[model samples]
Target chain A: MDKLIEAIARSGNPSVVGLDPTPALIPSQLMPTPGKDQNTAGTQPAHVDDGDDADRARSLADAYLRFNRAVMEGVQGIVPAVKPQIAMYEALGQEGVRAYIRSCALAQEMGFSVIGDIKRGDIGSTASAYASHLSGVPGGRGSSPWHEDAITVNPYLGSDGITPFAQAAEASDTDLFVLVRTSNPSSGEIQELKTEDGRAVYECVADLVSEWGRESIGEHGYSRLGAVVGATHPQAGRSLRARMPHTFFLIPGYGAQGGSAQDVAAMFDDHASGALVNSSRGIIGAWRTSEGYSPDMSVEEACDTVSQCARAAAISMRDTLLAALDAR
Target chain B: MDKLIEAIARSGNPSVVGLDPTPALIPSQLMPTPGKDQNTAGTQPAHVDDGDDADRARSLADAYLRFNRAVMEGVQGIVPAVKPQIAMYEALGQEGVRAYIRSCALAQEMGFSVIGDIKRGDIGSTASAYASHLSGVPGGRGSSPWHEDAITVNPYLGSDGITPFAQAAEASDTDLFVLVRTSNPSSGEIQELKTEDGRAVYECVADLVSEWGRESIGEHGYSRLGAVVGATHPQAGRSLRARMPHTFFLIPGYGAQGGSAQDVAAMFDDHASGALVNSSRGIIGAWRTSEGYSPDMSVEEACDTVSQCARAAAISMRDTLLAALDAR
Candidate 1:
């Protein structure tokens, strides 16, 4: 948490780039031309010549890596962290996961904290296994396969599931963000259910998240255990800020998710260092509508367009959030 | 649901061998000898000669695949299904994931339904991406990388996270099990939080799961959306069984987790067609205590011991469960 906080302070940007890649978000020029090797992303609906399923996955994974590298290059120094959503990689099966690790390793090399948006949760022993993402493989001599500085954990299974991750994060000097209130529309169906004590389920979970991180508060007045409060839930985010003061916030659901920069202003502490807003499609997909992008451009030219557009979008986001905080 | 119910009926066993392998659960005799290619399991604390992290994961994944294949062979005919908890494989990284898919494919080849215990959940597009486990990769010509007949999902994100999985399962003629009442000790943290409506959170989730699966009821009078009600919660299981009439159950926490046959009896339907009880370490690790097992034995002999002991333990589990249901 200290490392992340220091990075955020150094950049003076409380925002993270969500490196969540999808075929639709990638430039058409970057996709492989048809009738070529089945190991590249193609515009022809990823039709594999051979009936090899693994090849299809490998092709798409390769394209995702290209797009991610472009995006990572785009926002290298502007953003303190980049979160790669594992779902996108897992979609391509193991090959995509390999790309995800490469992306994380690249981000780390470029001096950015890598948050693996895995959201994995299970009971006791299994949770310990999932915590390996933070702890690295047992006796691997400090070789972490999944190079993540932090990860998002699901709290549905409660303390037994979360403790292992928290312990691992502490052991590795990494951090974890527990889902308190999600950005999705249907999230309220469970997270907002009013409890017997008149508190929403998210409130109870928020308290638990705060308590879980109580013992690990770093020098920056923030704990390694953080709460993921969506920007869509601005009122909830505002209340949670006061509620879990010691816990930092991973605020997702800005831009494309209907959350505005103003909506996230209250999520920060007085110093504006208690939260890091995330925007996936908003930042990574910025090249989608960029005027500089042309279908006739070569892969190298298209990649340049993507990198420039992403950097511009990320800078705009940081400025907007900072302005919102200043106005507040 | 129809396919799974029929398989269970064919075997007359409401049990699924849980293919969850750990370093401790795997026989040491089957582990690779020290100072080999460093591409296999070894008793030497997995000390890699070089600093190659990938090699470390590959070795552990190899051991897991071997253990899983042996266990699959042992339970092939007796059990209708096998649920491989993904957390164990994921601990070793992407190589572990490859092994996981191979294990699932092998189990399917052996005429067993593979249930992937991947409790994955996220919002809309992300959930859709994760649904690739059921629905094959786009334009792969029906090539499904994750060869599981069914997969588990978390319900904390509500219906938005579940609808894609349900739709994909329906499209692929597969099924999904949503977490309802988990078997963990601290499961009650948020699950049992009494809502203003007087129903616990899990009960609400149970109702939602029932409604979500209402349109997908199969020939066996069960829906594609199943509930993961832990065997540890006997009372809750009994109530949920009556509550979710059309939804099937994937009961975990049996055997090694302290769930007894009597505890899981009420989870079944009147015809014993509604649930599949899972026991992982209990059956897979049975060789550890068997008289036939000896560290001095060859790999073939050790695997044979694992097979026979796993088969014997799975049979005992099936018989105990049947007797409990008959008494009930």
Candidate 2:
């Protein structure tokens, strides 16, 4: 986690580009051509397809893999980390899952830490299995294919569910970001409810996160265990930062989710070392809606244009977040 | 959900076999051989490996698929439904995901309602994507390969996250089970906390679940949207059952998890409807440790023995639950 914070400092940016690849954002050239051997260099099943559901799903997943690889390459030096939202790839079925694993591996190979935004939560053995899947088990056989530097987890099941993940993260020397105050509109319905103790539900969760991370504090005075505090709720973000000083923050709901740099600046500390802001569609899908990029571009030209837009958008996001931190 | 209730009545049992297959539980004969072609039938990637991580993952996933198929076949008539815990399969990577999809399909084909215990939750678009992945979008493209009759979802993200699942359930005439009072020992850490309004957090969630199911009531007078109230929390389960009369309950934590039939009986209605108890290791892994099942048995003999044990265990569980409900 200190390494992650140091990387952020080295780049002078607290932002992580979210590689959430959707088919619409992928260039046509990247889509697997129909009739081309679909089984080319991966563990793809050998089911015969006739341009139906299987074929379409396989092609879509292929496109996602290509787009993610390109995006990682484009934003390599500018971004310290990448958070891949697993739900987007999971929508395409098994082929999509393959793409997700590949994307994470590609990002890790490129010197960028990957935060798998799975938001998985369960109880006991099931929870332990999830923890081991993301963070490899100690002295266990074979390497985990879906290894991530950190992973997002849901806290609905309480301590028993979260303890396994905490243990796994400690053993693997990785990190965890538990959901506290989410950025969604309806998050307030549960997270904002006041407890009998006069604290909101998210506040209670934040306190526990601080406790869980206490033993895992890095050299920078931040723990490997962190909280997912939405950028959309700037006031809550500020209070949570004060309440959980030793815990880092994975700030989401930025840019297209309606969170601005100024809104999320409160998540950081005096030196801007306690948080990582995320921007998904705003950066990767910028080519589709940005001013200079047009639909008339050829496949090859569109791929190049999208890659350039992604790099430029990353730089712009980094500058905006840095400026906000400076102002703070 | 009405169909689920009717199935329970027909089977004279309110139990579902949780098909959470692990490598250790699978017999050696069913395991995928190292040299055999793994991509002969499904959409397996063509990545060549030297029997390392990828090969081990693939073989383990194959064994899980075979084990799950046998368990479903063995318990087909006795159990009203089967809940496939996605985490167990997901631990094996992409090949594991494919196995999960196939296992669900096999159970559905065997005339059993498949509850994909994914426990997935996210906000807005991501939530909608998960719903669509489990339950195919209406009239959109080819059939969804990972389609299930119902899915388990987490509710930490609140109403916005659950609304999409509710909408999907209504659209597809499927069902949903939202996490309420989980069976884990530490569930009370958050769920039992008193709110400012003098209601327990789980109680508030119960009210929301009841409301979410109002618009999706089935012919049996039960809602397609249900709640996952742990069987281990008998008192809480009883209270929740009374509070959410219209909503069905998917009760987990039985047998190996320390939830006796008596403890879970409160979740059922007078006719033993409105709920389905889940027993994973108790039934599926019975052959491994139970008497009269030995390692010397051939693969064919072992598979047969395991299937027989599963059927017998399902029957025993059914009778125990019926007696408990009768006593209640």
Candidate 3:
């Protein structure tokens, strides 16, 4: 808990980039030739022939890998970590899956922790299998190839479903970010169900996550286990922070999802480092062309600008949160 | 329900073969040759060194594909369908994934509907992606290399998570099996939670499954959507049958998991076709010399005996239930 907090405090930003490689959004140059406009997504490029499912899937995987590698490599010293949404790669088929693995490796190589946003949940034996697949490579020592440093898990199946993941994380010194309060509009359907205790289901889950992190406390003051709390729900985030004091927050819904820096900042308590605010589409772009900035600006320049914006929002929120803490 | 009842009445059996391809259970001859038991899962005969993670994963995948194919081919006419557990294949990595696709295709060709036991759950957008990935190809029509006739889903994410899967099933004339009361020992941790309304969470999920199936009623009196009610939970299974009259049941925990034929027969609800009882390890190699099956009995003979035992149990149950119904 303390180590991650200390690291984030030293870095001066609580920014975490979400790598959601929407094929349609990849820049033109990055797209394999002939597949150039194919990457543009909804826009129909002229004289373009749609490839077979396998080929399109292959290209899509390539696009995802390229974009993810670029971001991880580009933001090495800037962001604290990268969360790769498994859905995006999964939509690409086997090739996309291969690309996802490559990207995870690249992120690790670039000195960033990889949070596999898989949201997987199951019962007993199946859950154990996933725990092995995600954290422990079958016969090997140390980290597994199919493993992630941490993964986003679905807690609907309850504590038993979470136990195996927690055990695997502890063994690997990895972590889990169970979905506590998701960013989706429909999350209220189940997550907000009123419990006998008067707490919503998400709150109930938040309390449990706190308990799960108890054994994996890192010297950094953060536990190896965490929670996925929506940055979109500022008030709920504030309340959950009180319930789960030691848990790390993977705050989604920032930037393109409509969550503001101030909203995300509220997730932190006294320390500016407890939350990792994520932005996917809001950043990672050929921003110069889209924003009509100078065409001469390099990819590095665009990333720097994106980083500046994300960092500014986080920093301002941290200051506001600090002021509130002091007043209290 | 009427159509399923009729099918069971005709077939005179309620047994289902679960395709759980654990690498450890693969036959020696079918495994890659030239390797000793000390290396590469002790099953792969070839690629003794197994070399890197990629190589070991590939070898394991080959074994899984071969095993699943043989099992599907072996039990095609005898069993109603093959319930392939997705986790087993997923553990084998991408190559195993390829094998999974091939096995599903083979099963479909053999006139057997495939029940993909993935147990996946997520928020709306991602849920849709999984539905598309499992039942159809991901990335729209013809974009995926593999597709199943039906997939098992988790209901923790609530209505939004389930809707997309139902919609996908509707579009493809495919089916879905949502987890209701899982057979795992610790399912009580969440699924058994009692609400103030006096309904357990699993019961609420069962109600939702029934409601979702209303949109996909088949000509056979059954809906394409189904529920995964573990055979181990006979009482819950009986209760679920009453609640989900039109939905099919994919029942796990037969054989190796210790649910007896009589215990599972209750799931059939007198008609003998309401549920598909899945036995993974028990049926896959019942005649194997290593597993202590009579060495004199051929594999086919073993399969026949097991299938017949299942049939007799189902028929006895059917008659008993029918007599009770007639008395009423």
Error of 2 at B103 (Å): 1.0
Residue A107 displacement in candidate 1 (angstroms)? 1.2
Candidate 2, residues A107-137: lDDT per residue as tens digits?
8889998899999999978998788665542
Residue range B114-222, candidate 3, lDDT tens digits:
7777777776767876665653334433333454667788776777888888887765556788888888777765677666577777887788778878977776668
Off by over 4 Å in 3: A1-10, A28-51, A285-289, A292-328, B1-13, B28-51, B134-140, B285-328
lDDT of 1 at B146: 82
lDDT per residue as tens, model 2, B1-328: 8777877777777889998887667776776554434333243344423235567677777778778877877888888899999888877777778889988878877889889999999988889778766544212242556758889998889999999888877766688999999999988888888899999888988898888789888788899889999988999998888899898999999999899988888788766778899999989988887676776777767777889889989999989988888898
Candidate 1 lDDT over B1-328, as tens digits, reads 9999999989999999888888789988655444443444343344333245567678878988988888888888999999999988888887888899899989988999999999999998899989988877754554568888999999989899999999999988899999999999999998999999999999999999999999999998999999999999999999999999999999999988888899999889888779999999889999999988899898888899999999999999999999999999
**lDDT for each candidate structure:** 0.88, 0.82, 0.67
Clash count in backbone of candidate 3: 15
Worst 10 residues of 1 chain A by lDDT: A41-50
Instruction: Chain A TM-score per model, please list them.
Output: 0.94, 0.91, 0.82
Candidate 1, superposed: residue stretches over 4 Å from native: A35-52, B32-52
For candidate 3, the chain B TM-score comes to 0.80
Q: Model 2 chain B — which ten-residue stretch has the worst lDDT?
A: B36-45
- DockQ of candidate 1 against the true complex: 0.52
lDDT of 3 by residue, A101-156 (tens): 78887887777767788887777666766776564435433335554677888776
Candidate that scores best on TM-score: 1
lDDT of 1 at B68: 87
